[model samples]
Target: MIRGDDGIRAFFAGLARDWRGWRGVRKWDTIEHDLAIKARHTGRKIRLNFTLRPGSDRDYWIVTLEMVIPPDESLDRLARDIGELFGDL
Candidate 1:
């Protein structure tokens, strides 16, 4: 969850429902990952991913917000890794 940006939550909620995102019903841990994402649509769909690294509260969070595309190869991997790990909990 990125702070100071309600837009991210408002956007991703459009693509999928709140419950699904909240539950994070998919399993990405079959691979190695650690991330939490809340995505939504503006003029375009945006997925905000946060990777909170350990041993450094100063650099704890990293956010990646990408515009939606038909072939979003880069975003997919980023999202996947993040989802498998953090996932809003």
Candidate 2:
């Protein structure tokens, strides 16, 4: 879904804006090609990491967003979120 630098920037911007109400949104950027966002889910308190990395091809980028769900979060809910984010992965 993410095409190039513009898409990456826009994605990070949206995450920053959307997660403002969470505890904190921390991000680290590489010189020209990578970005990492660390934040917790608002109500679930699940730790999430969103990373944007360059793709194998030129001018392409890939995004990986993962969550660390604790035992407190029900298996059903965790499964649902995972399914929504990464289908059949």
For residue 41, model 1's alpha carbon misses the true position, in angstroms, by: 0.7
lDDT score at residue 33, model 1, on the 0-100 scale = 34
**Backbone collisions counted per model:** 7, 0
Per lDDT, the best of the predicted structures is 2
Off-target runs (Cα >4 Å) in candidate 1 are 1-34, 55-67, 70-89
The whole-model lDDT of each prediction reads 0.38, 0.50
Give a tens-digit lDDT track for model 1, residues 1-89.
33343333333333344322332322211112333443443333333433433324536665544444322444455445545444554
Candidate 1 C-alpha error for residue 31, in Å: 18
TM-score of 2: 0.34
TM-score of each: 0.25, 0.34
lDDT per residue for candidate 2 within 11-56, as digits (tens), equals 3344434443444654544445465556565654446686777634
Structural RMSD, model 2: 11.6
Measured on C-alpha atoms, candidate 1 has an lDDT of: 0.38
Given candidate 1, what's the lDDT at residue 56? 40
